[model samples]
Target: MFDYADLLTYVLLVLKRAKLPQHENTRQVLRLVHEAAAEQNVPVRLASDLSQKNPFYALLAESSLIQALEIFAKGAHRCA
Candidate 1:
């Protein structure tokens, strides 16, 4: 499974510099991506180039992103 926690700090840093809404926006973006990907199969083996792959990478990424988004969103935002 692709873990977003490992990527969170880097992503947050970019968001911070961009002055983007942090947690809430992250959740929204993740959710939108997840919904968009519902029809396509996720590739299990991720390649920067096209090659043999499993079909779960996208789903896992989406789920992981959503999970990460929620953790920060609810933890940091009282309204969440």
Candidate 2:
């Protein structure tokens, strides 16, 4: 399986690049990502290129971002 920390870092970087106003939900997601990364000790892998066509890139809406974070959290737990 892919490394959740790396994925979280990637998502965090994307959010950083977005330069969007920080809403509470966004802050929560960021907090979760950091917590998850600290909890999960997975080996690092080379970063994979995300295609612009990916659904994630297309939908940066809050709902979609929350759902993505939820999935990552679940996956991280399973890995643990």
Candidate 3:
């Protein structure tokens, strides 16, 4: 399994990729998002529906977002 920083990078990639307009093909991005967020139980498939702008930056509600954070953070601890 990847360490936290690696997964963090993956999460960032997912978030950045989600910003593209809906008309654009996002299959690959979504797949990465699923892979990155799967462990955390974050809703990756629908995350692209969320805005890339201010307020509610993630498609996940606050609690699920926290879970994703925890998942990444735990990875960090494992490497320490």
Residue 56's C-alpha lDDT in candidate 3?
A: 24
Question: TM-score of each candidate?
Answer: 0.20, 0.22, 0.24
Would you list the C-alpha lDDT of every candidate in the order shown?
A: 0.35, 0.41, 0.44
True-structure RMSD, every candidate: 16.2, 13.2, 14.7
Ranking by lDDT: 3, 2, 1
In the predicted model 1, the residue pairs found to clash are: 42-55, 42-56, 44-54, 44-55, 45-54
Best by lDDT: 3
In model 3, the runs with Cα more than 4 Å from the true position are 17-30, 34-80
> What is candidate 1's lDDT per residue for 1-80, written digit by digit as tens?
33343234334433443232234246544443344346443332221111112112223443666665665564432111
Q: How much is the lDDT of residue 9 in candidate 2?
A: 49
- In model 1, the runs with Cα more than 4 Å from the true position are 1-24, 40-80
* Model 2 agreement with the true structure over 31-53: per-residue lDDT tens digits: 54455457653233222222111
Superior by lDDT: candidate 2 or candidate 3: 3
Tens digit of per-residue lDDT, candidate 3, span 1-80: 33344344455665664343342336754665666556545444444323322112223443575665665564422211
